[model samples]
Target: MLKFEKVSLTFKTEGREQHVLKDLSYTFETGRITAITGVSGIGKTTILNLAAGLLETSEGSVINTFAKTAYVFQEPRLLPWKTALENVTCVCGDEKKAKFYLDILLPEGSDKYPDELSGGMQQRVSIARAMAYDAELVLLDEALKGLDMQTKDAVVKTLREHLKGRTAIMITHDKSELEFCDTVLEISDAPISELKHVNR
Candidate 1:
């Protein structure tokens, strides 16, 4: 299980401190998919970074027990010089597994570089990379922003199958994506309460 205990996050920009999360506490249960939802710029991505240990919280602690982890950023974040298959294989070092995921997510562009694919195709490659990493905990930040409904359904189905017994936390504005989640969390402002959790 991954946990955030009384965590507070603040960032400094131009000598000014910005408080993103204040005394927040939440738990992402094991073997469940959680969707973090809110209006744009409500510090949703900050929570993911905090959980992933990519950023430090100003106070309290984050507890993670998972051995392997994967993260898919809002941007594709693929190496511009690498092909789609290479991006996934580079992480897991399993060419066959990478090919399997790419076949599901990017069947048409396995050999294509990031620069050679469209924005949506590149995003799919990133998704395939994360899925093929075989991580117990997967963190996705706006990971499905650019795909159409058919592709989104395919990718979501692939993710569901790949994440059967693992944990996934996604930051997204799309409500339809909640169908794949067992829980939903919405950040609430005005007095700054912890995230509102709903079980599906």
Candidate 2:
């Protein structure tokens, strides 16, 4: 489980201060898929960065009990020189599972490099890499932004199979993606509100 206790984050840009979150507290339940929804610039990515320990909070603490975590960002962030299969195997060293996920996400182009594939295909490769990492917690921020409806549904299905008994935290604007999540958290000027709750 991940818990944020009175977390406050502030950014200083151009010698000015921007307050993002002021003493916000929340807990992400375990063994569930949680989706964070909000408009652009509502500090969604900031929350993911803080959860991943990539960013520092001005005050308060973030408690993360999970052992391993894999984060998939908005961009593919793949090595331009690496092929799709190499990208997946680079993290987990499981070539068999890497090939399996790539076959499901990008059946025709596992051997292609990042530049050789389309934007959506590259995003799919990133998703496959995260899934192949086999981490206890998976963090995805706009990870499926470029895919078409059919491709998004297929990739969501693939992710669903791997997410069993594990935790997934995603930040997505696509409403269809929420179908796979056990809980949806909406962020805005107001406090976070639960959109749709599902019992597991």
Candidate 3:
């Protein structure tokens, strides 16, 4: 399981220190999907970044016992120079798994480059890369923010199948789009709190 114990982050935006997260304490169960949803400025991304170890907490601790992990962002963040296959294969495999995901997520001719793929296709490639990373834990931060309804459903279905038994924590505000999670969490100005859960 992954956990956050009294974790808080304070940053100096202009000059004074500002508190972003406030003593967040959360626990993620093994082989379960947890969705974190909140308003725009309620520090939703901050909590995911803290859980991802991308940012350090100012107080208390953020704990992760899992070994391998992968994170997907709102943007594809793919290397413009690399081919679609090269990006996914950069993890720890040959071309087989990369092509497998391309077959699953991409269109007929999206293996070319970032410049050639559409915005939705690029996001699919990003999801494919995250799947190809072969991690036990996956962090998704508003990954479907800009995709249209059709693209969102397709990618969400594919990603849900990919996360079959792995632990996943997703940061998103679209509650209707979170059918993939068994638990839901929402962050407020007070602290991180659990909003919903399903029996294991």
TM per candidate: 0.95, 0.92, 0.90
Candidate with best lDDT: 1
User: Which residue pairs show backbone clashes in model 1?
Assistant: none
- Residue-level lDDT of model 3, residues 16-87, one tens digit each, is 877776666777888988887767876777776877788988888988888888888878999998888888
Best by TM-score: 1
User: Could you tell me the TM-score of candidate 1?
Assistant: 0.95
Candidate 2, which ten residues in sequence have the lowest lDDT sum?
A: 190-199
TM-score of candidate 2 versus the correct structure, residues matched by position? 0.92
> Candidate 2 residues 1-200, lDDT tens each?
88888988888999998888888888888889899888898788888898899988899988889888889999999998899999999987989999988999999999999999999999999999988888888999998898999898898888889888888899999887888888988776732222334443
Question: Candidate 1 vs candidate 3: which has greater lDDT?
Answer: 1
Comparison by TM-score, 2 against 3, better one: 2
lDDT of each: 0.87, 0.86, 0.79
Q: Which stretch of 10 consecutive residues in model 3 shows the poorest summed lDDT?
A: 191-200
Ranking by lDDT: 1, 2, 3
